[model samples]
Target: MTHISKYRMKSRVEKRIKDNFLRSILSGGSARRQAILGELLTQTEKIMLAKRLAMIVMLENDFSYYRISKTLKVSTSTLKRLHRHILAGSYRQILTSLTGNRADAIIRFLEKILEFRMPPIAGPGRWKFLDERRK
Candidate 1:
């Protein structure tokens, strides 16, 4: 999870900075936005953001908690928190905009990457251990 400092900024100062930051991001083209994010976020932070987006997409699809927890390797607590956010309409606009194929593609891609495991060795039985059902 992303961390915030113990120190707090004044509400007005924070709001002004947040508005400017959002304006900077929203004014950019897709490539520029990607570049800015790539420069600003660490790999772990990027992965966390991606997984959160994937989790939101999965939740919108009405996937069961067990399947989502298993597939995303996220805690039930995290899912529960996000689920509450969803119920409160935190993701309303984004979910509405990403309906149908786009949402499905994101889910499929997330599953593909998260479920993948490297082969243990280069042999006939190399891929056997990669079978998740065996575990």
Candidate 2:
């Protein structure tokens, strides 16, 4: 069996993600995007993406990494990497641009419902735990 390098695989995936046809379909509207996503992704994949988005919103709202990890059942290392991505700015920009003020309102509502407490260090690059599980 041949193995693909991570960088090469990521490039390929990113290329597909940026494809014009895919972009057109995704930009078509919520119903179009939903239909395509439903067709392309499994239920578990959709759920995982939704969870990740929720985590992103919570992180932006100042929810603690540990608290989010506990509530969402995601690893701290995953949260840390996501935090780095947010701080890197692209995801933050996309989220804000896509959701507008509604994102903030929804996050606030979720925070109240989830009852998340702020941790002492919500800053990026603080988590030291490594994800050691093999895929």
Candidate 3:
């Protein structure tokens, strides 16, 4: 395809992705979302997307490239590309919001499981070791 045609096709696909049906399906509860994703995406595609999200979260948590790569089993080049996207600010806000919500949900779930509220971390520096850990 020509460059202009490719751009037009991309835009059309973007529009389709943003359509109400897809939005509503994705916005459903976890089970429904999982079902839809299972039907729509191949297992490999789902795994890759999960890994990408994990990388985004790890990057947001101040994890280093080496640590993320080692833990996620992804290459340095992939991490660099993700870092560029994060730095470019296209996915930063959505990634941060999604990660924050997920973190809160995990904390709540853990609290429910343990039958007690977990103490908050003392300070920002408390999590500095996360960079050193394998994850």
| lDDT comparing candidate 2 with the true structure | 0.73
Tens-digit per-residue lDDT, 1-135, candidate 3: 112343445777778866966786768699998888788777778778877877777777677888778766899999999999888886856675775679556444433433433344797666555544425
TM-score of 3: 0.59
lDDT of each: 0.85, 0.73, 0.71
The TM-score obtained by model 2 is 0.62
* Count of backbone collisions within predicted model 1: 0
Top model number, lDDT: 1
Q: Model 2 misses residue 108 by how many Å?
A: 4.3
Q: Which sequence of candidate numbers ranks them by TM-score, best first?
A: 1, 2, 3
Q: Give stretches of model 2 more than 4 Å off.
A: 1-21, 98-100, 112-135
Answer with 2 or 3, whichever has the higher TM-score: 2
| Candidate 1, 78-112: lDDT as tens digits | 99999999999798888898888999899788677
lDDT of 2 by residue, 1-135 (tens): 123456555777778866965776758789988788788777778778877888888887788988788778899998999889888885856576647677777676666656634444766633432222112
